[model samples]
Target: MYEDGEYGRGLVPYLSDAMMNIGTKVTYQTVIYPSASDDWILAELYKLKTMQTRVFVVHALPDLASRLFKKVNEVGMMDEGYVWFITEGLTSQLHNLDHKEDLMQGVIGVKSFIRNSGKLFDFKKRWKREFRSLYPDDDETQLDTSGIRLYDTVFGLAMALEKTQKEKGDSAMDSEGTRALKGGSMLLQSIRNFRFDGLSGDFNICHGQLQSSAYEIVNIIGTGEKTIGFWSPKNGILKMLDNETKGIKPVMWPGDSPVIPKGWEIPVSNKNMLRVGVRIGGFDQFIDADIDPETHQVTMTGFCVDVFKAVVDALPYALKFEFVRFVSSDDKRPAGTFDDLVFNLSIGGYDAVVGDITILAYRSDRVAFTLPYTEAGVSLVVPIKDERKSAWIFLKPLEKELWITTGAFFIYTGLVVWVIEHRVNKEFRGAPHKQVGMLLYNSFSTLVYSHSKCLCTLLHIILSHMLFVWFIIC
Candidate 1:
């Protein structure tokens, strides 16, 4: 029997009815804490164990199985439980996680989508094993069942487990105890011979795939080297494994080549090498691979097959391209150009400016970029706290202590002139003594000067008057 929807709000009465009908004595508790934090989840689980409840029908979201497993470890319990019902995602989703080897080891069940239909006892046994291994203090009497999203987790696990067991014994029974339940050995063996299709595709519990085949193996690479795992693209799918009895020639790819049928040839006369443009600083990724015009032997350079594959995947399969060359210093740097104004960027030349191109000194030829591609105007570098909030980090080192000290001296010089003339700014103004000391700063700030006659005159008048007044007052 089963109940649905949000636990207490929708199915409490139904669950009670099912328990009563099943004649099973059950104990329950309403222990509440911050049901949110992972810490709370673990602490509560341990506390629940101490409470003598055999089964916990948790009412949380289905995705909390991983959390529950991790928290259970935090609570100092290992591999103890009779049964667990988790509220989680579809069984297929769980299987996918497992396939990726990303399955959280401790989680044993799901409740969200009850995907399997089979006998209950067998599933209960396996689930009991899984739970005990995860939370060992758990036993049959404890029936320590708990899930984050309790309902979905339990439903999904129960369904998948039941369906799986039924499938094991699902085949038609044979006489002479061949398919009988006597340890189910013969029956399991028969089932092993049974290649039944489940939600995860076709699988045989008995005769393993490639079990009967023997083949010659060779060491293509003499020493230890990178190995590529060959996976059947159609492994475990129904549409696959149902092919008519036939033979297809084994495909081989040559050494250092990604092209399939490793030694195949293409009938061609002259080979043509082509060049294409990628974004700046991506030339290393677009090597035109070498191929024999006769044999189609695709030989790539040191360690770039995946990169090649990615580029190949991006383009259409019908079209073929090969990588052949790597960039050299000559390609990267410019030797001669159109004029001093125009800098050459490898394949082309353009007008140049100071600091217009990024070159590794001798290694690269400077290229002129367009006014828009590069900043057109002189950079008005505002203070970091002001307009430079989004300035590039590369420019930060350029504004280091040396430049700041030089600029500071210039600033101090200007400030001293301003102060001596009583035209000093409020921000820099101090008493006469401080002004005198800062006037010592004047020598360093050679460029902190007035470029206009009006400013110069004002500065001179203030300085002249202050000198006269200071001498007279002293």
Candidate 2:
């Protein structure tokens, strides 16, 4: 973690509490540097890279984050699996970061939700117009959320002061420049309860803190950021406005990959590689670990080993690890069961165990397991037969029950039409072929509104008369 002193005070504790509540053991390291100290920032980034910390939670001014990321990108470490999570302080300044967009690409940040309303849009338009007219030479003069919030706070305080003066009568005049207000506590209380709609949405306060409607999860794309989702205290993470909607827009992740990142991996600080335990008994084809006689180095290669390496590499951090053969000193036979290898992790014999280890309830109680990457239980592999070809493939999208229900609805509609119009209608009283065609047309037309010219005229008259009767009844 790298941040300036002022912003770090509030942000650090909140992030620490969040991590602790989720049972994550974090090794917190803080780097305090001035906002414009390039040398200091470069040194810190090098230290972080050495520590193998791929995910950095940056709590600083927007300029500092831009400088730090520029240095990081220059080092060629800004590719896949690196993550930078920033606080609202930096995100609010995104408009001014047009020049540093490449440095900040793939960054994730949080901001207070500001709904797009007509009133808000109008305010933005006027603000921009006035800004352009006043400072025509300045390129970065856009209003941000913080500025709006500050504007609201000043107005709220003014209203509270006015109310306090009315309640305190003439005594409020004496406290204007004499240390504090005569009813300052009362004025503060009034401000806390103030509620109204402002340019940034609902201007409200609760328990001396501004109530946040939601936290927008933004992803930095090209030159600006896009809202990929939102997190509300009431509804948790949502892709859309609410739970009923599809989701937020898709995000372009690091390296332009569309997949969501797995946020962590083993650290490779201190030039220490991970001590991996691999079993070599029952599943030789899945995994095989042995010592190279010529090189005297441990050699491990198999399906399971390949999968483990891929997972480690896919983590949003850099990790250095080497597989160690989990066998007895005798260099013969096998060790114990899969349970023994897992127990080794607890006993400090290995940092992690990788093999055909089945995740059972008993094993889970002893050690934690990640989400399984492969299918469990048995799978039968069958040969493909190229004998059959049919036109029924078009119906495969619908389920069997759905097809039956649809056919039943069509038949029922035809029967009901025949019964209703067969007696008096000339269209229904026809030859066998003509009767079938008329019945099919009537059945399908009921699904869609279609009718002959004569029937259409009669239906329009009936609808108009019904509407007239309904209007009179109302």
Candidate 3:
């Protein structure tokens, strides 16, 4: 993988872990760009072109990623046998990218999936009209996943507020005249429990987060992204949602090649021996380097050294390499620190580094570290204390908003029935106060099947059936 910035740094470890779990070994190389407009892009592209790995996972902001891809295309790295996969951060904003058709052609990307529905279609039409009116000059008004999620959020809040209003009337002020929603806690609870079939698929909130259902895998083709497949927790990768197939659809890869790239190959450059850097003074058990005076040949041994040799030997093809000791300027001792050794590898001083090198976040920014062979752990112990529970803890099972919503719906249903039956049924027709009393008594009494009133109007029966159907569907 070739990436840059903090996003790339954070993503590399997870990608490494996932690949390792699948019995695949991955190597990562960082592309350091001092700034967005740096002239080093072309040079960096050339350097990457000389490397053996053709498959690259890119994780950078849209601007930097776009520039990098442009340089990649200029250097002919987008040709056959090359593979590029971009993360959701860049892929989600594909519409904002300049010359994306040329820069991102045949690039594979994964983005949050938004299912198609009439609701989404209508919302898009209205959104496009309003967005165009506000920004007439801007052509990129198409809604993305972020926009869809934002819309869903606002819609959900509105629904929660509407329910709150029905349950507790308008917002009220305290004795100190501070305005607040009459049932603020209930409002928050309603928001957390809100669920809907929204533009962004099933909008369900759990543990204060909007749950993601699946990811849509897309391939950049011409002026748009082509949905090649989908990935979900339940199903791995499926070419069709209804199909149980385990792999993605055939991809139109870079250089328009239908054949899959092998991901890596031996560098074509004349340099044959891989320059492996070894720290000179690490613990002898992890690594040790020695030179024979008679033959003047360097021999490397120890745990790390043996493992490295075994890995290279197990490769499908022969890998010629020689261990190069990283020594001080005086040529008598090891380099300054492991940081110095990794920094040198970043600058092309070594093709790879092997020894008792600890993986640190700072060092990872400059170079990638392979999976550690050593077991690592850290534990912290803290004193535990007992505390008395709050008196309101009894309300914890169901949220306060759920209780309020239930009461509100009971009253609402009763009011609907009364409106339909008051004109025809004697039980519903009475003095204003008496009818109001009956409304409350019957509403609550229905929960215990203690209501004495009977539905005498056909409208009431039909409305009851409609409510039953609604409850069933919900």
Q: Compared with the true structure, what per-residue lDDT tens digits does model 1 show for residues 1-474?
A: 112335333554565677779775445544333245776666667555554333444433334444554565455432333223333232223432212122232222322211233533355567678877888775443222223223333443445444555765645344465754333454334434454433322323346331221111111222211112211333321221234323322222222222232111221322432332221222334333445789977555322345445654564212234432233455443333323223233434321122223334443444423333335577687755654565585566565775676556446545657554445344235797776555654433333443232244666665455445434533
- Candidate 1 clashes: the total is 49
Error of 3 at 141 (Å): 2.1
Tens digit per residue, CA lDDT, model 2, 1-474: 656586677668777889889875566566666645777767766666665456677777766666777787876556776777888888888776646567878888898888788987887788899888988898847778898788778878888888998998888766565645677788888988889887777888988888877888999988778889988877777888667454566777666777766655454456677888888877787898667889977678788889888887776456678777777788675577788888887778998888878989988887888878667688899998653465676665678887676667656666666665667577788798887887677655653454442233444454345345434533
Cα lDDT of all candidates, in order? 0.39, 0.74, 0.80
Assess the local accuracy of residue 419 in candidate 3 as a C-alpha lDDT between 0 and 100: 77
Per-model TM-score versus the true fold = 0.20, 0.60, 0.54
Q: Model 3, range 1-474, lDDT digits (tens) per residue?
A: 435667678887887899899986675566655374546878766777777778888877777777788888888999998999988877888888889997888899999988888988998999888888999997745688878888889999999888887887644335455665668788888988889888888899976777868999999999999999999878889987777888898899999999998776677774778899999786889898778989978889899999998898677444778888899888779877888899999999999999888889999899988889957787799986533376766666767787787768778767866777787679888799988886776665543552335656565464556457446534
RMSD of candidate 3 to the truth, in angstroms, is 34.3
Error of 1 at 117 (Å): 16
Candidate with maximal lDDT: 3
Candidate 3: segments with Cα more than 4 A from true spot:
1-20, 23-26, 29-34, 164-185, 269-474
